[model samples]
Target: MSSDPLPSFPFLNPGEFRSICSSFVNRVTGYSGDLRTLGWTNVKQDYQDGSAMLIISRIIDLPQWANGEQNDEGSCLQDDIEDDDPEMLIRPSSISGTSKVEMEYHILLSPTYQVPVLHFFFKNTLYSGPNALEIVYEHLVPPAYRSDLKQVGVMGGISMTNHPISGIPVYFIHPCNTASALQTVQGKEAPTAETYLPLWLGLIGNCVGLYIPKELFASLRNNSDD
Candidate 1:
């Protein structure tokens, strides 16, 4: 979260959804890397928890505003003194900090939900399982996607829940609009693929402040026609 260049989100079709996922990774604002495929329907990517997926940008020189925000500096100093790691020089005069927090994200196909489930995990990062979920709620997942109304037996909202397959805690966001859009493929009278899936994904991207180009509409249109 303290990274200089922060990140953003978005996606989908049946076969067309695959193409949308590809575009999202390559066309995202401030990022232009290819995501590696993990399975037939899963795309995997990593982002620096504090930077651009690898490096951590530390606040070498503390700012005045930060002083007020981190008013517990005295306690932090005491803790630092207790640790006494010489490599971590934490003093009033100078503080050289390093953080290499990395996180991996997955857009997984959910056969049950009939949509893609947004899931992510952090390694060597400050956020724990629940903390990561909160970050996704506050920074990544949109409010509308969350619902207090239980669909089956569970609650809604971005949840830090366990992935059914891996049994690991992760930040998860549900794709609420995927069902109706996918229905179009079955010859159902629902929103066209071009009209919904890419737009929904683009909204996800925009929520994360990613620049999903308007040209995406053109592509979505092309796919829907087929």
Candidate 2:
């Protein structure tokens, strides 16, 4: 007797894939008044690690602040200074760096499947408390995807506890066929807790298809000032 070859998984077109991603984000954050809202549900019960809780808790405790308020201390600024020499006076002597932090989340979706894979990187100041950001991306496989072993077949690996930069916890929803880098940072050091929180929240929102509230972003900025 001959065995039949495995059936190929249906590939999702760009429009279909975007729709699926949009639906996924809406389903996850639909309950929240704002996308930036953080609650116990956001943290998966089975995946609770203390560090993740701490980061979420701290964000919940921050006060509301606006994005462009003068009180906002994290604003990016450029300065021009002149020297005594004629050419020097015409042109600035040197460039001065300011305080700021940035976090990047990279999502890679393959042609074989619909679900998008996620990776993250963080850049912060040296004086910043912790150099890493704790991030978790969780997804419940749809019934259709679960039924097919060849299609899903352990597409992802187990979550990791520590990522580069900050020894902070890093978690993934599924493993990909090829190993990919998760978090990375190229800067003086990790960002402050306050600045880090907003960036982190934004990254989560992007993965889940939530709309981050401008007010919430402001709050993070305001808290960083203090």
Candidate 3:
């Protein structure tokens, strides 16, 4: 491996980061959910098998919007505070006439890290004249430096709980480390393999995001039953 230190990338503000992270979470989880509903038994396994490659590809593309590195002259930072009429703002046709809205957030990984972790944040609301919010996190795991195989994981947690505006569900996944079995050529610190696995997995599934709907939660429980 090259002796050079890993590359460094820009960091995003909390709101921007959260937005990207949420979207990623929703996409990955939604995909998983769809597969589960379709009775796909090996969805997780197949996902793991390809996650490394997918992550690397994303790293290379490094979309500006995803990382909040756009040149919009700070348009992203500005919020619509003065608008008295929500209708004044252009809304997607899909959400027209419906109070329900969904928003996405992104989290960028450190470029220098051998294994990158990206978080996707999602917000879902149901129309009821009151703003209801649901949050979810999608953790992205890229392959370790110089590794060919993809060793990705997904876990979910709850950030808040209350009413139709229940808290967000956060997901945690592991990235490659130098010292562990999924060692990286560029990593220096070796995360404790024995302890980190379960801890990471549980955190990914339990503490990161809030679970909504007993039915959805029940499905998750059953899926892990085996």
Worst lDDT window (10 residues) for model 1? Answer: 51-60
Instruction: List per-candidate RMSD values in Å.
Output: 13.0, 19.4, 17.1
Better of 2 and 3 by lDDT: 2
Candidate 1 displacement at residue 212 in angstroms: 3.0
Task: Supply candidate 3's per-residue lDDT for 112.
Answer: 46
TM-score for each model: 0.40, 0.26, 0.22
In order, the Cα lDDT scores of the candidates are 0.38, 0.30, 0.26
The prediction achieving the highest lDDT against the true structure is 1
Clash-forming residue pairs, model 2: 25-208, 65-218, 65-219, 132-166, 155-175, 156-174, 156-175, 157-175
- Candidate 1: lDDT of 205? 33
Evaluated against the true structure, the overall lDDT of model 2 is 0.30
Higher-ranked by TM-score: 1 or 2: 1
Q: Which regions of candidate 1 deviate over 4 angstroms?
A: 1-103, 131-133, 141-156, 164-167, 175-197, 203-226
Q: Which ten residues in a row have the lowest lDDT in candidate 3?
A: 53-62
Candidate 3, residue 58: the lDDT equals 14
